[model samples]
Target: MPAVGFSPYTLYSREEWARLREDTPLTLTEADIENLSGVTERVSTDEVVDVYLPLSRLLNLYVEASQGLHGITEEFLRKGNGKIPFVIGLAGSVAAGKSTSARVLQALLARWPSHPNVALVPTDGFLFPNAVLEDRGLMTRKGFPESYDLPTLLNFLGDVKSGKARVEAPVYSHVVYDVLQGQTLAVEHPDIVIVEGLNVLQPAILPKDGETIPFVSDFFDFSIYIDAAEALVERWYVERFLRLRQTAFRDPAAYFHRYASLSEVEAREVALSLWRTINLINLHENILPTRQRADLILRKGAGHAVESVALRKL
Candidate 1:
């Protein structure tokens, strides 16, 4: 276990980590991963390296550990140890860089010696289409747990973790904000499958009838929650909104094209309002509460630096 900081719940100072875990043994070049995930222009966040890099290595270790355990336990049903998928769950609030962190980890974990078949499956794929949400009167709660196809998501994870001969997950298009039925992501039996989304750790929302159901996180050998203060996350949302207003929203075919040309003041207002109305509510009621269920927590500082990490004690 890593030494604790002044606080009992936190450990890993920036200076101490930088010295102990320099970015070495990374097969992926910086040029390929220079820009952090979800960051279009550029980012100056300190957590990009010091925190995420070590976290990536830690995940790799977890993958290896799971493999060891699996081999010993499944003596009868065993096959040759060529490669097995390592599914990781990445969860966080809006503007917390959960998507970015997910992409970064996918790349990092793939480059690791253990798993070259690393693949990413964002829960965005399971989000109900915009029209469907509108039909259900849930357009306002787009990212909320209720807006997703929980059954499909759970089944998808089951197949991924089951070592199925072939598994396909529906692909969701952002422009349309719907799952393209019959369109699927083909997995050639990945060595690692990283599932990223807002409520990946949420328990299965089952019917009242007495029946057992496997929650998505139940299959996750290791899960991470990217955490940040409310204020910081709000600021990031505003900044990202403004940036998108200038770029993606400008695309005529973009789903958010209506947001283009929003003035700085108007954009900030919209961002704040959305955060207060939708994102914040989801975070408080569904997302944030699941943080305790995570195996690791990446707590960010004001400047988006991962100032501390909390790992559940074995």
Candidate 2:
């Protein structure tokens, strides 16, 4: 733990961080970025070049160093030690652009020659089925920690870290707003895995007894937290809701289809109510508290562009 009143991270402005890109080449085209950007996100080419490229370079370095260390340990043991997947945890508030960041990182990280086979796994897939949530009357607390199947999630991560050749993660559908029954996403052997979620950084409760307890973050080789001001996140949430109302909410298959018919004013009110009542509470009580636990923090400005980065010191 970091000392009280002493910051553990070294902060860098966008300009300073961009400079760290150095000789890193921009491998993604505008078309690639457009495809990578989330529905409510606008990932400008400059953002990728200035922000993501540097991050890609840094991560490449970390992956190479971790691989080297593993090889050294294998040599010391005088045995053929198989490679373990490097797992990264990304966390943030609902509308803080974590999905966009995760997608961007997946794309950028895959382009690195050393770790071309990178897997992106979302923790949303581990959420308890809607039927179970309704039965437990946890529908209102859907994104809360209790709503997830923690043991299954831990098992999946444990498998990945233990160098399991193939791992299948459960699937969730935003269109239906539920964990899809009998659906799963396969993650084959990859050099790295990025696990993105609202509460991936959440810490496990310590038992008074000295028994061992595992956490989602325990499997992480690195972790990132996307952060923004509460007001900014609220505005972005409403904006995204308004966009969904005009687009996805219109689909009959969408769980939020009912919201499509709402008037603009009604939609705005509903979005605000949901934000204030649900998301804000989760952010305050759960997400924000885990921000400091991340190895890196990306602080976004008003336009969802990363304005600064805080990297924890070695």
The most accurate candidate by lDDT is 2
Candidate 2 Cα errors over 4 Å, as ranges: 1-5
Q: Write the per-residue lDDT of candidate 2 for residues 1-314, one digit (tens) a residue.
A: 85688789999999999999999998888899999988788999999998999999999999999999998998999978588788999999999999899999999999998899899999999999999999999999999999999999999999999989999999999889999999899999889999999999999989889696788899999999999999999999999999999999999999999999999999999999999999999999999999999999999998998999999999
Q: For each candidate, how many residue pairs have backbone atoms clashing (under 3 Å)? A: 1, 0
Error of 2 at 164 (Å): 0.3
Error at 123, model 1, angstroms: 0.2
Please give the TM-score that candidate 1 achieves against the real structure.
Answer: 0.88
Tens-place lDDT digits, model 1, residues 254-303: 87788787788888898899889999999999999999888888888765
The lDDT of each candidate is 0.78, 0.94
TM-score of 2: 0.98
Per-model TM values vs. the true structure: 0.88, 0.98
Model 1 lDDT, full chain set? 0.78
Q: What lDDT score is found at residue 138 in candidate 1?
A: 97
